[model samples]
Target chain A: MKEPLLPALKMTLLTLVLFSGVYTLAVWGIAQLAPNGGEGEIITHNGKTYYENVGQQFTEDRYFWSRPSAVDYNAAGSGGSNKAASNPDYVATVQARIDSFLVHNPGVSKAEIPVDIVTASGSGLDPHISPKAAQLQVQRIARVRNLPLEKVQALVAEHTEKPLLGFLGPERVHVLKLNIALDNLK
Target chain B: MNTEILGVIAIYILIVLLALPLGKYIAKVFAGERTWLDPVFNPLERLFFKLSGIDPTLEMNWKHHLAALLGINLLWFLLAMFVLMNQGWLPWNPDGNPSMSPHLAFNTAVSFLVNCNLQHYSGETGMSYLGQVFCLMFLQFVTAGTGMAAAAAVFNAMRERSATHFGNFYNYFLKSCTRILLPVAFVAAIVLAFSGTPMTFEGKDSMITMQGDTVQVSRGPVAAFVAIKQAGTNGGGFYGVNSAHPLENPDYLTNAVENILILIIPIAMVFALGFYLNRRKLAWMIFGVMTLGFLLLSLPSIYSEMQPSPIANQLGIDGSAGNMEGKETRLGAAASAFWGISTTATSNGSVNSMHDSHTPLSGAMQLIDMMINSLYGGVGVGFLNFYIFIILAVFISGLMVGRTPEFLGKKVEAREMKIALIIALLHPFIILVGTALSAFIFYHNPEIGWLNNPGNHGFSEMLYEYTSAAANNGSGFEGLGDNTPWWNISTGFVLLLGRYLPIIGPVAIAGILANKKYIPESAGTLKTDTGTFGLMVFAVIFLVAALAFFPALALGPLAEYFNH
Candidate 1:
C-alpha cells in the first residue's frame, strides 16, 4: 500500500494541475467561440435584455401564456415541482390550472387542455411550449387582444418551431419570441 | 448517415480510444508499479496511511472488506443526513435554500452513499451550496472510489494463487480516490467551468427580460459539481434539469465532453481488469460483449427519436424533424438519443434531454438499457455485475459438457452458485416488486394520481422510476410527481439494497473462488476468454433480463410503444 501511495499522490497533483488549470482554460477558450461566450444567448427587444435560452413568464390574457413554472419561472434556479402525481397538492395544482384556463377562455373545454400547459416542465426555464399548448391559448389571446382569430392563428403557425431535421422533437412555440411578435402586430 | 449521426458515432469511437490508455495507466497504478507520478503521490499516500492508522502491509478477507465498505458508507449517510437536514443555517448557502424534508434527506443521503444519486428533489432550490459540496460532492468521490476499491479487491482475490485475504480496504479506497477519481474529476471540473458552468457561490442574480419583467436566475458551484457528477457516474445534477441546463452543458463541445466523461472510466475499468490479471483477451471479450449490447440499445434509440412523432402527423404537422420535444437544440435529436442510451447504460443518469418526452419506443429503449444495466455499467461495479453473468454462463456450459465448472482455475460450487443466483435474482425482484406496488397503489386509489399523462404513457413513467432505482441508474421520467414521502422512502430503500447487495455478493464469490483448489487447464476445460464464451455471457444477460422484466416492460414502455 505504501509503495503505491507516492505514485498515486503525484498523479493526483499532476492531474489536478492539468485538469483544473489547463483543461479548464482550454475549454473556456473554446466556449468563447460559442454563442454568447457560453453566458447564454441573449436577445434585446424594446430596450430590455432577455436571455433567449431561459423561459419567460407571461400571465396576461392578451399574451400567450408560458408553461407552468415550479420556481415561478425563476431563471436563477431551475427545477420541476417534483410533486408525485399521487400527492394531493400536485393534483390540486393541476386542477387549479385547468379551472383557471377554462375560466379565462370560455371557448376552451377542460378535456382539451394539454398536459404540458398544466404541468411544469422539468426545467423551470423551458422557453418553449408544445404547439398544442400555444394553440390552446390562441383563442384567449385573440379575444383579449381584440385581434382577428385567423390572423392570430396564422401568427401561431408562424411562431411554431419544427423539430430538428424534421423528425427529432415535437413541434413547439418559443413563448417569448411568439409573444414579442404578438406585441409587434400591426 | 447525416453529419449529426456520424458525429455521435465518432464520439463513441473516441471514448474507446481514450479509455484504452487510461486502462493501462490504471492497471499500473493498482499494481504498485513505478510511474511518472510516483515521486509526487508516494509521500502523500504515506501521510494518509500514517495519519489514518491504516497499515499498508495488512490484508483482509472478503467479509472484512465488505464490513469496511458498509461501515464507511453508513458514516457517510449519517454525515450527509446531518448536513442536509441543517443546510439552511449551514455556511456557503448564499441562496438561503431551506433544509430538506426528513424523507427527502434520507433518500438523498442514501442515494449518494450508494452512488445511486436518485435525485427526488431539485438541486438548486432543494439544497444549499454547502450541502451540495459537502454531502453530495464528497459522496461522489468516495462512493465511486468505494466501488472501484471493491472491484480491485475482487481482482486481487482472483489473481492470487491461494489466499483468503485480498488487500487492505482502506488502502484500496485511498488509492482509488487519489490515483483515479480525483485526477479525472479535477480535469473534468475545469473543463466544465471553462465551458460556462458556474463555479461561484453567489446567490440568485436578478435580470430583466426583453418583456421588461424581472426574473431571478439561480447559480451556484455547478462546474465543480458537474465534473464529478459525470466522471464518477454519480449522475445527480447540480440543477434540476441535470445536464440539460445551459449552465450545466453550455454547448455541443460540452455535451461531447460530458458524454465521453460518463463512459471513459467504466470502459477503462474493463481494460484495467485485463491488464491486472494479464488476461487481455478476456478483457477484450468482455468489452466486445458490452459494446455490442450498447450498440444494439443505442441505434434504435437514435432511430426512434429521429422519426417524426406519429401524433404530430395526426395534427397535420410536419414529421420531418426527429423528436425534439424534450431535447436542447444545441444537442439535437441524435446527440440527445445517444445520451439517453449512454446515461442509462452506464448507470450515469445525467441527461441532456428529458427521457419522459422521448418517443414511446425511445423511452422503452432507455428503460431497457437500465433493466439490462451491465452494458459498460458504472465504473468498477459494472464489470462486477457482468461477472455474475459470466459465472452463470460458465456453470451452465460446464454442466452441458459434463465437466466441473471452473473460472480462472477455481471450481464453481454450490456456495458460489448460490451467491451468484442471489445477486442475479435480486435485481429483477426489487424492480418488479416495486413497480407492482406502485402500479397497484395508483390503480386502487384514484385520488393518489401518480400517473400524469394517464393510460399507457403514465404507466411507463412509474416503471421507469423503479427500474432506475433498482439498477442504481437514477434518471427519472420527471413527469412523475416523485418528491413525495412515498417515492422518497421506497426508492431510498431500493437504492441502498440495489447498490450494496450486488457489490457484496460478487466480491464474496470472488473470495470464495480464490480460496478453492486450483485446477490446471485440460482439453475439457471451458475457455472463458474466447468469443464463444462472451456470446454465452451476453445471451445469459439478455435471457435473464427478458425473463424477469419482459412482462413489466410490455405493460409500460412496450404497451405505450404499440399504442403510439
Candidate 2:
C-alpha cells in the first residue's frame, strides 16, 4: 500500500496537467475557430446588443410572450423549476400563469392555453416557443397594438421555423425575433 | 426510415466496431503487456511509482484493497467539500458565483465522489470555473478510476488461484486513469470544442437580443467538462439543461459523438473481460445478453417517443411530427430516444432531451434501464454489477440441478452468496424505501411541494429520482424540485451507499473465491461461460429488477401510460 502511494499522487498530478491544462488549452484553441470565437452570438438592434440564442422576457400585451423562466430569463444561470407535477406549489404556479394569460387575453378560452405558455421551459433561456403558443397570444397582441388581425397572423406565419429537414421537432417561433419583427411593423 | 434514425443506427454500429479494438487495447494495458503507448507511459508510470514511494510489486488482500479505495475516496470527499464550500474566496471566480450552501456542498461532493454526478445545482450559477475544473472534473477522473481499479482487483482475483494478494490497488487505479480515461478524454474534449462547446475561462458575456433586450450569456470550460462527464459516466453538466444546450451539443454530429462516448467504455469493458479471461466466446455471450436487453428497452422507447403526445392530440394540433417537447431540433425523436435509453443503461445520465417530457412508456423504459443498470454499466463497474446477477443465477441453477454451486472453479458457499445477495438487494431496498418515504411525505404535506406534474406522472418523478440515485445513474425527470434540504441530504446518503457497497461486495466475493482451492471444470460443474448460463443471468436480472420495481412502475409510468 505504501509502495503505490507515490505513484498514485504522481499519476494524479500528471493527469491533472494533461486534463486540466493541456486538454483544456487544446479545446480552447479549437473553440477559437468556432463561430463568434466561442463567444455568445450577439445580435444588434436599435443600438442595443442581445444574445441571439437566449430567450428574452416580453410580458407586454402588444408583444409575444416568451416561455416562463424559472430563472427569470437570466442567461447567466439556466435551469428548470424542477418542480414535480404533484407539488401543490408548482401546480398553483402553473394555475396562476394560466389565470394571468386568460385575464390578458379575454377572447382566448382557458383550454386554448398551450402547455408551453404556462410551464417554464427546461432552460430558462429557451428562445423558441411552439407555433401554437405564439398563435394563442395573437389575439391579445392584435387587440393591444391596434394592428390588423390578418397582419399579425401573417407575421406569425413569416417568423415560424419549420422542423429540421421538415420532419424533426415541432414548428416554433423565436419570441425575441417575433417581438422584434412586431415592433418593426409600419 | 428517416436519415435521423439511420444516423443514430450508424453511430451505434460504429461504437460496437470501435469498442472491439478498444477492448483489446484496454486488456493489453491492464495485463502489463507491451503496447504502443508503453514507451510513453511506462517510464512516466515508473517515475510516478518512484516519486510516490510505491514499490509497484506489493499486492494487497481484499481488506487492504478496500481500505485503500475507501481511504483515498474519503480524502477526495473532504478536499472536494472544502473546495466547493470555499469557492467564493477561491480563485477563478470571474462570474462571482458564491460558495455552495453546506448541504448542497455535501450533496455535490458525495454525488461526484460516488460517480453519480446528480446535480441539484445548475453548473453555470452554482460553480465557479475553478470549481468546475478542480472539484467536479477532478472527481470525475478519480471516482471513475476507483471503480475501474476495484474491478481490476476483481479481475486479478478471479484470474489467480490460492492467492491471498490481489494486485496493488494504486497501480490499477493509476493505470486506469492514465492509460484509459485520460487519453480518451483528451481527444473527446478537442472534438467537443471544435463542435462549438466553449472552453474558455471568461465569465458571462452580456448580449442584446434581436428585440433589443440585454441577456447575460454564461460561458465556461464546458467542452473539457463535458468530455469527462460522458466518458467517466459522471453525468453532471456545465449548464442546467445538460447536453441539451447547443454549446454542449451543437449539432447531430456532436450529439452522435456524445451518445457513443457515453456507452463506449462500458461496452468495451465487457470485451476486456473476455480478453483477460481468454474466453472470447463467453464475452460475446455476455455482450449478446446485455445488448438484447438494451435493444428490448430502447426500441420501445424510440417507438413511443416518435408517437404524438396524447395532450398534443387532444389539443387538435398536427401530431404527425411526434413529441418534440423538451427535445432539441437537431437530435429529434429517434436520436433523443436512443440517447435516453443509452444514458440510463450505462448510468451515464447526460441528456440531449429531457426525460421528464418523454411520453409515459418511454419514461417507463428509462426507469427500467436504470433499475437493471448492468446493461453495459459505467466503465469497469458495469461488469461488476452483472457479476452479482451471474452469482445468483449460478446458485439458483445449481439448486435446480441438484448440485453444489460453484463459479470459476471456486465453491459458491453461503458466505459468498450472502454478500452477492446484499449487493443485489441493497439497490432496490434503498430505491423503493426512499421512494415510499418521499411519497409518504408528499402525501401528508402537499405544501412541502417538489413535484411539477400531478397524478401518476408526479409519482413517476419521485420514483425516478430515488432509482437514479440508488443505481448511481444521475439523470432525473427534471420536474422534481430536488435542491431542497429533504432531497439533498436523503439522496446524498443513498448515493454513497449505492456506489461503495456495490463495488465492495463484488470485489470481496471475488477475493474470497480466489483464495479457495481450485476445482477444475467437470460434468457436475455449471458451465458459466455457455449461452445457457448467459440466458440464466439475463433471466435473473429481469426477475430481480422486476420483482423489486414492478409495483413502483405500476403506480408511476405504467399508470400514466395506460391512462393516456
Candidate 3:
C-alpha cells in the first residue's frame, strides 16, 4: 500500500511540473507571435510627452479611436474627469480639442469634426470610437494616405461593430487596432 | 405610453406564466430527483468533488461556511485576473488579443465572480477561446452557485429557531450547483445547441464570404456556457456582444428560451419560499408584487416605442417595432422590446437590442429598473429581494398596529430594521455616489475616451455605467469607455461592495433572526399575502428609488433624452 501511494504521489508531482512547463512555453510563443506594430511618442503641443509602445500610438491614418484616458500627468491622479457637461473646465477642454483637431485637419469644416473627437470620454481612456466618429474622419484619412476616398470609407465600414445581433448598442470601431491596420496597409 | 404599457403587461404575463411551471421543475431537480428528461450529470459533479477531495457531508457553522465560500471565490478571482492579464502569453490565441491590464483584469474577475457581467472589454475581440472557456464560462457556474448558496443560508435563517447552525454550506453549495444549476444548464445548453448556438473549439471562422472576400467571424464553445449563464442569472455572455452574436443567441426560439430561463428560477423562488414556509399564497403574493413592479416600470417604454418616430414613420417601417435602432431584426418588436425589460427585471443585462437607441420614455424605464436594483432579480438572488421586502412589510405593519415587528415569527426590532434599511438603501447610495463621482469628478480626457461618445449624453453614459456597476446589474444605456483605471478600478470596486455588502447584511439578518424564536401565527400578524400588501411593497420600492435619484437622473439621462 505504501509503495503504491508513493508512486501515485510521484506521478502527480511529475504531471504538475510538466503541465506548468508546457503552459509557460506556450505563453512565450504566443507573446513572440503577437502583433509587431509601429510605436510612437505621445507628443502634446505643450512639449510634454513620453515614449509609448504599439498600444498607445495615436496615428491619424488609423480610423480607430481608442478609449479616453483621464490621467492628469501633472496631478498624477488616474481618474475620469467626471465633469458634468455644464462644467466650465469640461467645456473649455472640448473647445480646445476641437480647435486643435480643426487646425490639424486643414480644409475640414467645424461640423466635420465628430463630437467624439472633441468630447472627453467618461473613463478618459477609451480605446474604441463610435461609428459616427470614425466615419467623420474618413475624408481626412483618405487624403493623408492617398487612398481613394471610397477605400478608406470602406475600411471604416468593415471594422464597425453593429449593435449586438443588429439590436444591442450603437455601431463601434476599435481605434487602436484600426489605426495599426491602416499603417500596415499598402 | 399606453401601447408600451400594454406591451409590458403582455410581456410580464407571458414571462411569469412561462417561468412558473419551469420553477417547479427546477425545485424538483434541486430536490435531487432524476428526471427522465434531464440526463444524469451527477457523475461529472462527483468527479469534480472527488478530484478536489471535498466531502459532501462536511458540516459547518454559517461563519465557517461563508469564509470557505469567500476563500474559494477569492482564489478563483485571482486566478482569473492573472489569466486575463497574461492572455497574450496564454493558449488558444485565435485572435492574439493582449492580456488585460491590472485594472481591467480586476474588473472582469469581480464582474463575473460577483454575478455582475458588466464588461469593459468586447468579447469577440478581447478574449481568446481558452480565456473565454476557463475564466468566464466556469465562473458562470461558480458565481451562480454562490447566489444559490447565499439564498440557502438565508432560507436556513428563516427556517430555524434559536439555532446557530445554518445547514451545511458545502452541502447547500453542492446541491445548488450539482443538483440544480448544472442539470438545468446542461439541458439549456443542449437546447441552445439544437437551436444553432455553436459548441466547438474552432478558431474564428476563416471561410470566404459571398462577396469573395476572406473575413474571419469569431466562433467558440458558446452554447455550453450560455445555457447556464442566463438560466442561473449569471449574465456573462461568451462573446463580448453577449446574446447579440448569432452563435450565442442564434434565432427567435433560442432567444425566447434563454430569456425565460434567465427569469424563471428567480420568479419561482416566490413559490420555493412559499413551499419552504408552507404558505404557497405568501409566495404568490411576493411574486405578484414583483410582477406588478416589473410591468409598471416597463409600460412607459413599450408604449413610447409603439408610436411612430417621425424619422421611422416616414420610412414606412412599423413604428410598433418600437425603437428598432439597436435591436436585432430577428428578435424584432416583441422579442427585443420584451428582452430589454426582462433583462433589467432579472438583473441580467445581456440585451438582444441597443438600449441606447430606445425611445426616451423606454430608456428612462430601463434606467428606473437599475434604480430599483433588480429586485425582480436573478435566480437565487430574487429571493433575497423578496426577503428584504418581507422584512419591510412586517416592519411597516407592525408600526401601524402599534406592536413590535415580527416576520415569520421572528421579532423585527430596531436592530433588524436598521440592518434591513441599510441593506435596502446601500445599493442606491452606491449608485448615486458613484454616478455623481464619475460625472462630477472624472470628465473624459484622451486617456479615457474608448467609446468616443460625446457631450452631456456622454456624461450620462458614464453615470449609467457606474450605476449598473454599483447596483450589480451589468447593463449600460450609454456606451462606456471602460479600459482606463478610473472606470475599471471604480467599476470593479462598485461591483465588489455592491455585491458583498448587501449579501453580508442579509446573511447577518438571517443569523440574528434565527436566534429569535418563531411566535405562533395569530390574528395580529399582518396578512401580507393580500394584493393590498403587494401594492404597498411596490409603492415603497418606487418611492425610495424615486426619492433617491430623481435629481441626478433628471440631470443625466432624462436631460439627454429630452434634449436628443
Candidate 4:
C-alpha cells in the first residue's frame, strides 16, 4: 500500500488532467461544429430569443400551453413535480389542471384532456407535447385568437414534428414554436 | 404496439448485439492481448506509467490490488472534496453556484468516489462547471476503471491454474480507461452534441419567452459530462433532473444513445468473463439469467406505467394517455418505465422520468431490482456481486448433492463460503438498518419536512433513498428533500461501505481460491456453467437478497399498490 501511494498520487493527477482537462476540451472543440455551437438551439422570433429545446411557461388563453412544470418552467434549474402517481394530493392537482382546462376550453370534455398536458413533465422543461396534446388544445386557441378552427388546426399540423425516421420517436409539437407560428399568422 | 415501444426494443437489441463484441474486446484488453486500439493507446499508457513512476508489469495478489484500488481512491476522494468545496472560487463557475455545504460536499465526494453518485444537490445551482468536470465526471471514468480493474484481477485469479500473483492493478485500470471507456465516451459525446445536447463552457443564457417572461436557460459542457456519466455506469446528473433535462438528453435519438451507452459495458463485462475464462457457454448462461431477471423486472414496470393509473380514475381525469405525472411526452410512459428498470438494474441511475412519480407497481420493481442487484449489474462490481451469488449457489447445491463443492476445479472451502455469505448479506443490512433509523426520525419529527408526499409513498421515498445508497444505485425519489445532515451523513457511510465491501469480499475470496491447489475436474464436481446451476444461482439471490427486503417493500410499494 505504501509503495503504491506515491504512484497513486501521480497517476491520479495524470488521469485527472487527461480526462477532465484534455478530453473535455477535445469534446468542446467537436461541439463547436454543432448547431448553435451546442449552447442549446436558440431561435429568435419577433425580436425575442428563446431556446427551442427548453420548455417555457405558456399559460395564456391565446396560446397553446406547454406541459405543467413543477418548477414553473424554471430553466435556470429543472425538475419534476415528483408527485406519487397514487397520492391523493397529486391526484387532486391533476384534477385541478383538468378543471382549469375545461373552464378555458368549454367545448372540451374531461376525457378529451391529454394526460401530458395535465401531469407535470420530468424535466419541468418539456418543450414538446404529443401531437394529440397539441391537437386537443386547438379549439381554445382558435376561440381566443378569433381564428377559424380549421386554420388553427392547420397551424398545429404545420408545426408538428414527425418521429425520427418516422418510427424512432414520438410525433410531437414544440409549444413555443407552434405558438410563435400562430402569432405570426396574418 | 406504438413506435415508442419499438424505440425501446431497438436500444435493447442494439446494446446486447454491441456488448457481444465489446465483451471480447474487453477480455483482450485486460488479458494483455493485442488490439487495434493498441497503436493509439500503447504509447499514451506508457507515458502515463512513466510520469506516475509506476511499474505496470508488477503482478500482485488480490491484497495488493485492493490496496492499490483503495490508495488511489483515497487520493481521488480528497481531490474531489477539494474541488467541490472550492468550486465557487474555482475557474469556470459561470453560474456563480456556491461551494457545497460541508455535509453536502462530503456526501457528494464520497458518493461519486464510490461510483454511487447519489447527488444531494441540483447541478444547475449547486455545482460549478469545474465541479461538474473535475469532481464528478472525472470520478465517473476512474471509478468505473477501478471497478473493471478489480474484476480483471479477479478474472486472472479464476483462470484454472494455481498462482499467487494475479495481475497488475494499474495496468488494467489504465487499459480500461484508455482502451474502453474514453474512446466510446468520446464518440457518444459527439453523438449527443449533434443531437442538441449542449456542450459549452458558457453560463446560463437569458431567453425571453413568447409570453413576455425572461427565463435563464442553464448551459455548460453537458454533452461531454453526460457521455461519460452514462457510459461509466455512473448515473450522476449534469443537471438537477438528469437526462430528463432537454440539454442533457435532447431527444429520442440521444435518449436511445444514452440508454444504450449505460448498458453496453455492464452487459459486456459478463461476456468478457466468458472470454477471459475461455468459457463462452458460461457467459451465455450468465447473460441468460440476467436477461430473464431484467425482463421479469422491466416488462412489469412497462406494463404498469402504460396502464391508466388508478389515481387518474379517482380524480376523474382522462386515463387514455396512461400515467404521465413525471414522464416526458416525447419519451412516453412505456419508454420511461423501461428506463426506470434499466437504470436501476445497471446501477446507472440517471432517469428520463422521475421514479418517485412512477406508479406503485413500477416503483416496487425498481427497488426490487436494486435490492437483488447483479442482474447485469454495474461496471465490474456487478459481476463481482453475481460471483458471490455463484459461490453461494455452488456451495448450496454441493450440500444438496452431498459432495464437496468446487468451481472451475478449485475447492470452495468454509473460508470462501463465509466471505461470500457476508458480502451477500451486507447490502441488505446497510439498506434496512439505515431506513429504520431515518423512518424513526421522520415519524418522531413529522415537521422536519423531509417528505414531499405523505403516508405510504413517503415511506417509499425513505426506503428508496437507503436502497439506492446501499445498492450503490443512485437514482432517488426526488421529492425526498434529503440534503439535511441526517440523510447526507448516513447515506455517505452506506455508499462507502456498499461499494468497497462487495469489491473487497469477492476479490479476497477469489484470491484465496487462486492460492489453493488446482483439483482436476471429475464427474463428482458440480458443473457451474450450466442451466441448472443458473437456476440455483437465481434461487439463492431470491432467497438471500430479495426476500430480506420483502417486508419493507410491502410496507411501501406493495401497500400502495393494493390500496384502492
Candidate 5:
C-alpha cells in the first residue's frame, strides 16, 4: 500500500508555523528600545532658517547648518544626484547648492565653503558631513557664535569616528552628535 | 601563498582521513546495516517516517526517489521563506533587527536552501539568535545533506548492475544529515569554540577601537555555524564583515584551520569517489588535475598581490604589508589573499578580504575562477561537475575514435552529453547575460549610484558582482550598490535559476542514463582514468569558459586591467 502523505505535510506545516511565530516577536521588541526620534534645532543664514527634521523646525539665533540631507522628500529623495564627480551635472548641482548657501550667508567666500556643503552624499540622505567639510564651516560657525574657530573645530574633531578596524571603511563624522555638542558648548 | 599552501595540504590530509569513515558509514546506512548509534535513533527515525507517511520497507526506483527529494526541498523552501520574512518578531533579538524585505527574504531562502548562502542581510544586525538557529544553521545541514544525497545517488547509479533504481532519497538525506553532516559540524564547532569563536546568547558588543572610541563589534552564534558553513562549502558569514571579523574568525591558527576544514570534505570526496568506484587511482587523477589547475590559476594572483604597489607607497598608504585594503590585519595579506582565491575557486564565497579592493590582476583571476564556475565547486557538487566534464571529454573522444565512450564501465551517450553541456554552460550563461543586462540596460540608470565611476573597469566590477551572485559565488567588490531592490530581486532571480537548473540538468541526465542499456566495455572503450583525459576535461572546462565569458570579461575586468 502507498504511504500516506499527510504525516510529512503535517511536520512541514508545524515547522513553518513555529518558525514564523518567534521571528515577529524579536523585531517588535527591538523597536521599543530605540530613541523616540532624533531631536535638534535650526541654523539660519541671512534672515531665512532651516532645521534637519520636522521636530527641529526653528528660527534659532545661533548654530551651524550641517550637510543637506536629500531625504527631504519635497527637496531630494533618498539618493545622491548620482552624477559622477567629473560630470557636468554634478558640477552644476554643486554650483547651484553653493549659490543658494552663499545667498543665505553672504559674507562667506567661495573658498570658505566646504565641499560637503555643496556635494551630495552617496545616499544623499547622509545625516553627517565630512570632517574636512565641517572644518571649512568652522570659521563661519565661530564668527556667528562670537567664539573662536579653534573651539568650533574641536567640536567637529570630537564627533569624528576614525575608520572602523583601522581599515574597513572611510572615517566619518556624525552630524547629529556634533550639532548636539554645539548646543552643549553653551 | 603560505597560508593557501598550508590550507591545501591540510585539505589533502583531512579529506583522506574523513572520506573512508564517512563513506563507509554512508554505505552501511544505505545497506541497512545496524550500528551502535542506529538503535538509539531507530525509534526517532521510524517515528519521523511514520509521521511523514513514508514506508521504510518500500523499494523505489530513481524517479520516485527524485520526487521525494523535490518534495522535501519544497518544504525547506517554504520554511526558509517564512522564517526570513518574519524574523523581525523572532525571539532573543536584543538589538531589534527588522524583517527582511520581501524580495531579500525570497533571495536568501533560495540561496541558503540551495547551499548558495548569498546573504543580503547581516547576521549580527539583521537576524535574531533564534532566526540564525532555525533558518541559517538548519539550512546548512539540509543543503549539505542534499548535496551528499545527490552524490550517493550518482554513486548508486554507477554501482548497480542492471537495476534502474538509483536509491531512496529520504533514507540518503536522513543518513547524510544525521550520520555525516551533524557529527562533522559538532566536532568542528567544538574545535572552533575552543579556538575562541563565540557560541552564546550574549552578543559580543565589547567596543575596542585602535583610535580610542567605540566601534560596534559584531558577534552571534558564529562558532555553532562556522563549522558546517565551511565544511559544507556553503560560505555565508555570521556577520557582514565575514571572516575578516576578529570574533567570527578568532586568530591566525583558527583561520588556517577553518580554511583547511572548508576544503577538506569537498577535496576528500574526490578520493571518496575512488573508494566508491574501487578505483583509487582515478580519484587521485581527478584530485591531481583539480589541485594543479587550482594552483596554476591561483598562484599568479597570489604572487602579484604580494608585490607592493609604487603608487600606494607614494600616497603613504602602506602596501608594504601587501594589498591590505579591505582585509583585517589579524589575518594579514598572505592569509587574506589565500582565503579569497581558495574560497571562490571552490565555490565557497566566504571572503577574508574584499575582492573589489584587490589589484586588477588579482580581481581578474577571481573572475576567471567564476568563468569556469569553479569546478571543485561546492562540497559534493564540485566533484560532480568534474565528473560531468570527464564524461563529456570521453564522449567527444569516443566519437573521434569511432568507439563508444565509457567511464568506469558506464556508457556516455547523447542524452548524457546534452545534460552535461547544459550543466557546464549554465553558470556562464547566467554570468554573461546578467553582466550584459546590468551593464547595458541599467548602466546609465540614475538609480545606479555605485556604478557612477568612469570607464569599463567600474562596469566590470558591477558586472562581476551580479555574475558572482547569480552563479552563487557571493563575493562582492563592495562597490556594487546591490542593497537596492533592483539588484536584490534581479540577482536573486539569476541565483535561483543558476543553482537549480544545473542541478536539475544533472539529475535528469542521471534519470535518462538509469533506464539506458549499458554497452559492454570493449578494447575500443575510451578510458577516463588517465592524465590525458584529465587534461581533456580541463580543456572542455576551458573551452566552455572561453566561448561564454571571454568577450564579456574583456569588456569588463580585462579592459579595466589594461586601462589602469
Candidate 6:
C-alpha cells in the first residue's frame, strides 16, 4: 500500500482543490441566479420569512392541515415517525388524529379523511399534501373562516397542482400557499 | 392508469434512454479516446499530474492499482476525520454545530471514504458547512471516481488482448471525475438549485409558522452535495431526512430528476463494461439479469405500498391515497415505493420516503434488494458484484459439462474459485453476524437504546442497519436510534469490509485471469455471455444470497410482514 503513498498524497491534495475549491465555486456561481439565490425559495409575510417549501404546522381549523409530522414540522432538523406500518403506538396516534379531526369538523366522516392527513411525513417538513387531502379540509376552512363553501373549494382548485405533463406525478396542493391565499380571501 | 405508476415507468424509461449515451461516453473516457470533453479536461488533468509530480500514463498491475487505491483512501479517511472532528470551529461553520465525538468521527470518516455513506449522524446538526462540502461532498466525487477507476482496471484486464499491465488508475479516476461525474453533477446541481434545493452558505434561518410556532429552517450548499450524493450512489443527505426533506427534493419534477441521477451512473457503468470489452451482448445479458432482479423486488413493493397502511385500514379512514406514513404526498406512495426499490437496488440510499415506516411488505422488498445488491448496483461496484457471481456460474457450469471452467477464455482455477466464493458468501456472513450480535446484546441487556420501534419491527431495524452497512447500500431503517458507539463502530467496520473486499476480490480475480495466455474461442468453449449463462449467474446469486440471508430475513422483515 505504501508503494503509491508519495503520488497518492500529492494526488489527494490536488483533488481536494479540484473538487472542494474549484468545483464548489462553479456550482456556487450558478446558484447566484437560482430562485431566492439558492438560500431556498422563501415567503415574506407580515414580518417573517417562511421557507416556501418547508411545511409549517397548520392544525387550526381556519387553515388546511399539513401532513402529520413525527418531528412536528421541525425545520431545524427533519425526521419521520419511523414507526412500522403495524406499530401499535403509531396506530393509536393516527386514531387520535382522526378523533380530533372529527371533533374539529362534525360534518366530515371518518371514511372521508384522506390518508395524507393521518400519516406523518418522512421529512416532517413536507410542505405539500395531496389534492384530496386539501379538499378534505376545505369544508372545515370554509366553516371556520366564515367564507362560502364554494369560495374555499375554488381556492383549493386554484392551488391544486397537477401532475407533471398532465399525467406523471401525484396532484398536490402546497399547504402554506393555499392557506395564505385563504387569509387573503376577501 | 395511475399517474404515479406512469411516473415510475417514465423514470425507468428515461434511465435506460439516458444510460446508453452516457455509457458510451464513459467507455471513451476510460479508453482514453478523444471526445468533446478532452479539450476541456486534458489541460486540467495535466495540471493535476504536474502538481502531483506523478506520471498519468504509468502502467500499473493489480497490486500497484490496489496499493494506490488503499493509499489515497487512507489519506482521505484522515482528512475526513480531521474535518469532522473539528467542524465546530471550522471556517465555514455558519450553523455553529459542535464537533463529533471520537468514535462518531471514526464511523463517519470511514463510511464516506468507502463510498458507503451510512450516516449515523444526521446532517442538520452534526455537520458544518466545511464538513458537508470538503469532507462529505468531496468524498462523494472521488470515492465514486475511485470506484470507477477500479472498474476500468478490471475492464482493462478482461479485454481480449493479453496485456500484462492493468490500466493506470489515475487516468481513469481523473477522467471519471472531470468527464463523467463533474459534467452531469454540475448540470443536475444547477437544476436542483433552481428547484429549491439550497446551494448557499447561509446558516439556519428562523421563521414563525402559521400556527405561531417559531422554527429554525436549516439550509446549506445542499444542491451541490445532493447532486453527487444521488449521482455517485453515495446516498448521504445534507439534511437528516435525506431526500424526503422538501428542500432537498422540492417537488415531483425535481424528485424524478433526482431519482434518475441515482441510476444513471450505475447503469451507465454496465454499458461502459460492454463498450470497453467490445462485448455489447455480454453487457446486455448482465444488465438483463440485474433488471430482472430489480423488477422482481420493485413491482411487488409498488403494489404493496399502493394499498392502505395498517393504521388507515384498521381505523377505516379512507386511504385512497395509499400508505402515506413517512411518505411525502408530492412523491406519493407508489413513487416512494418505486424509489425505495431503485435506491436499494443501486446502493443509492437516499430516500423520498422512510423505509422504516413503509408497509411491512415494502420494507421487506427494500431489505431484500440490499441483501442481493447486484441489481444495476452501486456506481462502479455493481458490475464487480455481478462478476463474482459470473465466476461462480462459470465454475459450476463447467463442472456439469465436464469441461474446464473459463470466463473470457481464462481458466477458472482453484485460486479464482476460492476468492469468488468468499466474496459471494462474505456479504451475508457479515450482515447476519452483526445483526445477531446486536440482537443478542439487545435481548440480554435491553437498555442499550438502539431500537426505536417495538417487537419484530425493532429486529428489522437492527437487521436493516447491518445489511445496509455490509451491502454498502447505506439507506437505513432510520427508526434505529443508531448514533451510539456500538452501532457506529460495528457498522463502520462492516462498511469498510463490505466495500473494499468486494472491490478487491473481483479485481484480483480479473487480474489473475487477464495475465494467463489467451486462448481463441473453440466450439467446445463455454459462452459466458449467452442467455443461459445469464440465467445461471442469476440463479447462483439468488441461491448464495438466499441461503445466507433467509433465516435472518425471516426473523426480521418477513416476520414483521406476516405479523401485520
Candidate 2: regions farther than 4 A off = A1-18, A40-73, A81-121, A124-186
Candidate 3 Cα deviation (angstroms), residue B27: 4.1
The 10-residue segment of model 5 chain B with minimum total lDDT is B206-215
Worst 10 residues of 6 chain B by lDDT: B160-169
Tell me the spans in candidate 3 whose CA falls farther than 4 Å from its real position: A1-186, B1-18, B25-55, B310-321, B442-456
lDDT of each: 0.79, 0.82, 0.62, 0.90, 0.62, 0.89
Model 5 agreement with the true structure over A65-95: per-residue lDDT tens digits: 5444332312111222323222344445556
Error of 2 at B420 (Å): 0.5
User: Which one wins by DockQ: 1 or 2?
Assistant: 2
Sorted on DockQ, best first, the list reads 6, 4, 2, 1, 5, 3
Residue-level lDDT of model 3, residues B1-564, one tens digit each, is: 233234334445666786666556555544445655445446644554465555555555657666666766676687688778888889887777788878888889899888888887777667886677667766776677777777777776776367776665555665676566665666676666555565555565442311123434455566666876787676777765567544566555677678777677777766666665556787788877777777787656655655554223333322333443344433444456667777777777776655654555666677777777645776677677657767887788678779777777778887878988988888778787777676655554444554335555565676678777866778775346577887888888889987877677777788888878878768877677788877777777776666787887787667766664
Q: How does model 2 fare in lDDT?
A: 0.82
- Put down candidate 2 lDDT per residue, A7-107, tens digits, no spaces: 45555566566666766777778778766676655566788776666678878787898878777777777666655433456556667777788898887
Cα error, residue B501 of model 1, in Å, equals 0.7
TM-score, structure 2 vs. true = 0.87
How well does model 3 score by local distance difference test?
A: 0.62
Model 1, native contacts kept: 0.15
Error of 1 at B420 (Å): 0.2
